[model samples]
Target: MNFDLQGRVAVVTGGASGIGLAVSRAAADQDMAVAVLDNNAQAVEAATAELQDRGFKCLGLVVDVTESESVARAVADVEASLGSIDALVACAGISQNTPVVDMSDEEWDRLVAVNQRGVFTVAREIGRRMVARGSGAMVVIGSTDTIGGHINHAAYAATKHAVAGFVQSAAIEWGRAGVRINVVAPGAVDTPLLRTKFDDETAQRVLLYNVPMGRLSRPAEQANASLFLLSDAASYVTGTTLCVDGGLTTGFFYNDQVH
Candidate 1:
């Protein structure tokens, strides 16, 4: 099946690095006019320039997803300068791994602010525009941790679960209006963010033991999933979380004895 996104305009949050950057590049590769929104001004400028050097129609804007006003301004800027936003990929988020009992109010609040609330802010603003235009698609980057609880990740998991709910509810409400909302729940991807979680040896062992694929997922893999969800190829898909977790959520176990 063809996954053509030619002439489309896509806005990706947290697009300066990690999964967001990868998705931005993928969208550009598909000939879509792309914009990268990040809180880091330098990074956003650099990334946007790099993509432009590579012959992609791109723009960069500094945005703090946690603030509704900031999000609205950024979306407005993109719409005014970059043409109508055909797709929005809410890839901006943060993660924390504090145990539930040890988690502080601040930690929980920060995670919710950046992850769940950020998602809400971006989706709401973009969804409003999409509804006004009567057509659009949104892909939210979530986590597989939301499926089966992970140790020391209560705050992160909670936000991801909320994302799922938001996607479903939004989809139900907006589907008939020619809009689609979906979530891409990634497993342990080998991005800079994941690298910060553990030492090399420990990270490898964890992936080998837990991930059925026996390795961390690549950023490109997740980007591909996002691209599909955002493209017309997935026109009929909405309100669903596509788990691109390398079989992590499918259930795997360790056996004491070797076969």
Candidate 2:
């Protein structure tokens, strides 16, 4: 299916690795000029090089999405180097699996800063540009935690909920301005972050047992959903949350025992 994204520009936060990198590669495959933004300089360099070697138009920038000034600079740089941002995929985030009683204040703050505030900062900066131009699309990467509460994931779940809320509110506010904002909540995907939680084969098997698909998701699967939302094919869609979780959040599976 043609996404009709050729020659457009896309900014993908956390584009150096995981689902963000998947999004970057997918965007580039659609012939879009991709700006790969992440906090890790080395990863950014490597990702950019790989894309360039593949003959894709891409730029890599190390950005702290939690800081507005940093985001503003990255946005400006992207526009200066590529063009006006036509789409944004806010994918930079952090996660932890700590029970409410054992979670530290610093861990809570850190997750909020990166996952919640970081998504907001990048979206706000880029969303403003989209609004000013009177046209754009955005997809914020959320999690299944946004819907179902998980064990030892109080903080992570809360931040995801915040992201969903933010997307709905922003979509409503910017709908008239020609800016569409939405969330793509992914379930268990094979990423470094997921490895932290399900490190061993036994843990992974347990996780798969809960998912109806009987397996974990691939990064490309999440990217496919995100790119669809960013494309004109979903022009009429807004203020929605698309769960690409292989039916993991169908509420039929028990999660309490997994953790």
Candidate 3:
């Protein structure tokens, strides 16, 4: 399928590392001028430098996605550098594994701020511009928890559920403006974030036991899904979620034969 993203401009939050970094590289690989945004200023520079070394056009920015002013400024900077925005991949997010009963209100708020509010802030600012131009596409970084329940994932899952709802509603509102909105929900992606879920090796092993693929997804695999959603090839796909999990959300059983 043709991505048709050449010469376009895209903003990828959390693009400094992990899956966001992969998506940023993939967009640049497709000839899109990329704006890599993240709270970590140093990582942003490293990421942009890496892309530049690869001969890809890219800009790195320090952005706090939870703040509307910060997001607006970042978007303005991206447009100033690369021209009008053509796509957005809202991949800035974090994970927490505390049980619901033990989670503090502050922790809950922090999760909501980054996972839910951050997505809304970026999408709203970008969507407004896209609506005015009457053309654009966006892909939010949702998680497998968006559709299924998980133990010790109360706060994280709640925020993702909110993001999922926002995407659906925004899709309805933005469809008429030629702006497509969708989500890519990944399960057990092999990113630094995944390793933070457990304190010991045994817990990680048990978690992966149920995955039918028997391994976490690669960052590029998840990025490919987002790239498709942000491209012309997905013209008819909107207000939907593409799960890039290793079949963890669908259904999985132990092979019993693995030793």
Candidate 4:
């Protein structure tokens, strides 16, 4: 699949590291001018510098996705610097593990703000630009936990569910205007975030038992899916959630065999 994204402009939130970083690199590799929006100012600069060193046209901005003002400013900056935004990969998110009953209001709010509101903020802002130009694509990063119920992930799961709703509604409203909205739900990916899930032994065992692939995903693998969704290759695909999980949500297994 020749995903020729050359000459395109992409804005990726949380593009400093992990899956977001990988997506930025992938887009740049395809000859797209990328603007990475991230909260971590230092990391964002470093990531941008690394990409530039590799001869990719890239820029980095510090923006808190949860804040509308920040998001708006970041989008405006990217547009001013990189021309019209051709694609948006909303990868800004946070996760926490807490029993539903014990989850604090602050924690819940933070998760929802970053995961759900962040997606809306970036997508809405970028979507407006795309609508004006009459062309654009958006690829949101959701999680398989949204499908497979997991323990102590109420906030995260709820936010991911909201992401699906956002994508669907946006697709319906914007498809006529040539803006495509989609999502990529990854299973277990070996990123800094996943590492915070548990200790080495428990995390390894859990991933092994749940994922038929017997390992966590690489950031590049997840980025590949996002790139495809944002590229012309998926021009016909919209209002959908594509699972990049390693068969984790496909079916249940009993003694390593599907029932």
TM-score of each: 0.94, 0.96, 0.93, 0.94
User: lDDT score of model 3?
Assistant: 0.88
Stretches of candidate 1 off by over 4 Å are 252-259
**lDDT on C-alpha atoms for all candidate structures:** 0.88, 0.91, 0.88, 0.88
**Poorest 10 consecutive residues by lDDT, candidate 4:** 250-259
Residue range 77-97, candidate 4, lDDT tens digits = 988888999999989999886
Residue-level error in angstroms, candidate 1, position 51: 0.4
Model 1's alpha-carbon lDDT is 0.88
Model 3 per-residue lDDT at 162: 91
> How well is each residue in 1-259 modelled by candidate 1, as lDDT tens digits?
2469889999999999999999998999999999899999998989999999999999899999999999999888998888999999999998875668998999999999999999999999989989989999999999886565666778898899988998999999999999999999988788887787656677666655666687888998999999898887889999999999878778742221221
lDDT of 2: 0.91
- Which residue pairs in candidate 4 collide? none
Candidate 2: the clashing residue pairs are none
Which residue ranges in model 3 land beyond 4 Å of their true spot? 196-204, 252-259
Q: Could you give candidate 2's per-residue lDDT for residues 130-237 as a string of tens digits?
A: 899999999999998887787888899999999999999999999999999999999888888778657667555666667778778899999999999999899999
Runs with alpha carbons beyond 4 Å of true place in candidate 4: 196-200, 253-259
Error of 1 at 89 (Å): 0.7
